[model samples]
Target: MALGKVKELVSSNPVVIFSNKFCPYCVCVKQLFVLKLGVQYKAIELDQESDGSEIQSALAEWTGQHTLPNVFVGGYHIGDCDSKFDLTP
Candidate 1:
């Protein structure tokens, strides 16, 4: 179910960020996309969700990444904070 939800979100949004509100890395990623690049994105605050744990677990299974700021772009998993920065100039 959680995997299905993740898939639905990834497919529907051009950019999706699975994040935690308090994580600094998550904040950085959000700022880089929304502020630095001025790109619109859907941010799913996992810590604020009722099934946050389940969603995180599903994200790990799907992406092989067990970290905050899991990012997706145009239906492709873009990895974590460091990975996102690596793609940027």
Candidate 2:
């Protein structure tokens, strides 16, 4: 997409995870990556109205599934928290 938009997303520390603020799986993912793994990330809660409509639209366009906890790392789609990280276990 646009470089400016991408820059906006990655403006966080290490990564950015788009979440729903309700899903337990999403919480687990963040805890694992940030608290446990010691990685820093700015999480976006989609269920909240704080973010603008453009961000919601952009998220739908990128992931194609309007589900909670859609993730992004370095501005790249990494799927949801559980599926993105643990495929074997």
Candidate 3:
């Protein structure tokens, strides 16, 4: 739900999930953040077929390129699951 389909509600909490309409990996990513880690966050879904979306813009701002399942914490883009593994340290 990008391109105004959803508006990001800013918060002091860092962890977040960049999701899409039908992605199992994204769902798992969100689960790990919420269920496993018990972290709350802002979930932004990208509209992949609508030419582009705000998610892409955010990706351009926070990261160098647009990618799905992008996660952030502590105001830093820590990437996906692999990056999250680094966060544990």
Candidate 4:
């Protein structure tokens, strides 16, 4: 179920970020995409959602990444902040 939801979100959005509100890395990733790159993205703040843990678990299983700020671009997993920075610009 959570995996299905993750797939739907990734397919629907040009960019999707699974984040935690208080994580500095999440904040940085969002700012880089939304502010620096001027790209629009759907940010799912796990700490604020009821099914956040399940969603995160699904994300981990799907991406093999167990970290906040899990990013996807154009339906492709873009990985963490460093990965994003390396790919961008």
Which candidate tops TM-score?
A: 1
Every candidate's CA RMSD: 2.7, 4.5, 4.6, 2.4
Q: What range of 10 consecutive residues in model 3 has the weakest lDDT sum? A: 2-11
Model 4, poorest ten-residue lDDT window? 80-89
**Candidate 2 structure quality by residue, lDDT tens digits, 1-89:** 33345347765445787776778987887887877889888877767855535566777775674665667666566677445453232
Residue lDDT tens for model 4, 23-73? 999999899987899999999999999999999999999999999899988
Cα deviation at 43, candidate 4, in Å, is 0.5
Estimate the TM-score of every prediction.
0.92, 0.66, 0.63, 0.91
lDDT values of the candidates?
Answer: 0.93, 0.66, 0.63, 0.92
Model 3 lDDT tens row, 1-89: 44233224323446656678577877888888789988887776765545346556756565664666777676566776445346553
List ranges where model 1 is wrong by over 4 Å. Answer: 84-89
lDDT of 3: 0.63
For residue 63, what is the lDDT in candidate 1?
Answer: 94
Q: List model 1 lDDT by residue over 6-48, tens digit each.
A: 9999999999999999999999999999889999999999999
Evaluation by TM-score, superior candidate among 2 and 4: 4
Q: What number of clashing residue pairs does each candidate have, in the order they appear?
A: 0, 0, 0, 0
lDDT score, candidate 2, position 4: 43
Ranking by TM-score: 1, 4, 2, 3
Better of 1 and 3 by TM-score: 1
